[model samples]
Target: MALQIGDTAPTFSMVDSDGTLVDLSALKGTKVVLYFYPKDDTPGCTAQACNLNENLDYLSSKGYRVIGVSVDSNAAHTKFKKKYNLNFSLLADTEHELVNKYHVWVEKSMYGKTYMGTARTTFLIDENGIITDIISKVDTKNHSSQIH
Candidate 1:
């Protein structure tokens, strides 16, 4: 079943670009902007990540800790983060555990070719871990406005 507002966000323990462990359960007291992207360094994904990074301080002022998730490896995330100077955690979900749990991994079509990939979705999780909103139609360049 798809997750909805009021549903408790699934807890996850994944390593970030720096190989540091990030556990969802450890973020209980702060709001979370858990965003899933298809790939690192892709145009749309890059725009979204950069926009979020640019507005990170504003979002943080509202108590939202942004965390980007993708099936990319830690090495890819590190390079991407450095290239963009991203100031947030990019969780390496190479095993697809987080995507599957969040139900963002789905069939995708491009150039008439069908494949499985991550959907660009953002979950607004409240301080207590309950999902307050889900942004399925993300505006890559202005995502921070959509969240905050």
Candidate 2:
């Protein structure tokens, strides 16, 4: 089922790019920007990651915690974050549990071929861990203000 606004974000514990285990339940006092992207280092993904990187200070000042989730492994995430100087955490979801729980794991078709992959979706979660907004219209070029 698609997680709607006001729904409680599924509690998950995933390894971050730095190999730290981050549990959603532990961040109850802060707003969270949980973004799910298709992959790492790709054009759109890079743009989106950069946008978040540039505005991280602003987001943090507003009491928001930004986290990116993808099917990429910890090693890949570490390389991508280091190469791009990303300041936030990229959660590794190799098992696809969180992806499926949030319903971002979707069927996509490109170049006349179809495959199952994550859609570029984002969830704006509140301090109480309830989803406040859902951004399924991710255009990488304009991702910065999409959270606002």
Candidate 3:
């Protein structure tokens, strides 16, 4: 079942681009913006990440830490981050563990070809680890405003 707004955010341990282990449970007492995207460096994904990167201070000011998740490998995430200068952590869900745990991995369609992929979604979790909101239809360019 899809996670509901009042549901507790699933705890996960994933590796970031720098090979640092990031455990969601460790981020207690901080609001989290966990976004799942299809791929790193893609047009829409890049736009979304850049928007969040540009608004990192605003998010932090609101006591929110942003984490982007994708099935891309850490090397790909490193390249994307370096290329775009993204200022937030990008979790490498290469094994689809976190994505599946969050239920973002599902069947997707592109050009009428159905295949498994990451659905662009964002979960806003409060300090207590409760989900406050879920953005299923993300606006890539105006994402920060959407969250704020």
Candidate 4:
């Protein structure tokens, strides 16, 4: 089931692009914008990440710490970050741990072929770990406005 607003955000501890551990519990004192995307370097994913990168200062001003989760390997995330100059951490959920916890892993269809993949979803978690919002239809280019 998808997580709902007001539910306590699921806990996650994953490796970032730089190999540092990022845990939800470790971010308790700050609001979190946790986004889950299908892959790194894809067009939609790139646009979303870059859009967030562009508005990082604005998000920071609003006391939001942005994090992106994907099934991509840490190496892929590192390249994507360097290529796009992304300002936030991209968590590598290679084992689909966080993705499954957040219920973003689902069956999808494209070109008449169906397969299981990561869904584009974002969770806005409050300082107390309760989710304030969930963005299921994320507008890649104007996402920060939605968060604000």
The model with the greatest TM-score is 1
lDDT of 3 by residue, 1-148 (tens): 9999999999997778977787889999999999999998889999999999999999999999999999998999999999999988999888888888889899988899999999899999999999999999999998988895
TM-score of every prediction relative to native: 0.98, 0.96, 0.97, 0.97
lDDT of all predictions, in order shown? 0.95, 0.91, 0.92, 0.92
Off by over 4 Å in 4: none
Each candidate: how many clashes? 0, 0, 0, 0
Cα shift from native, residue 37, model 2 (Å): 0.4
Q: What range of 10 consecutive residues in model 2 has the weakest lDDT sum?
A: 139-148
RMSD of each: 0.7, 0.9, 0.8, 0.8
Q: Alpha-carbon error at 79 in model 3, in Å?
A: 0.2
Best by lDDT: 1
Please, what are the lDDT tens digits per residue for candidate 2 over residues 1-148?
7889999999998778787778899999999999999999999999999998898888888889889999999899999999999988999889999899999998999999999999999999999999999999997876768886
Across 56-132, the per-residue lDDT of candidate 1 in tens digits comes to: 99999999999999999999999999999999999988899999999999999999999999999999999999999
lDDT, candidate 3, at 93: 84
lDDT, model 2, position 123? 95
Of the candidates numbered 1 and 4, which has the greater lDDT value?
A: 1
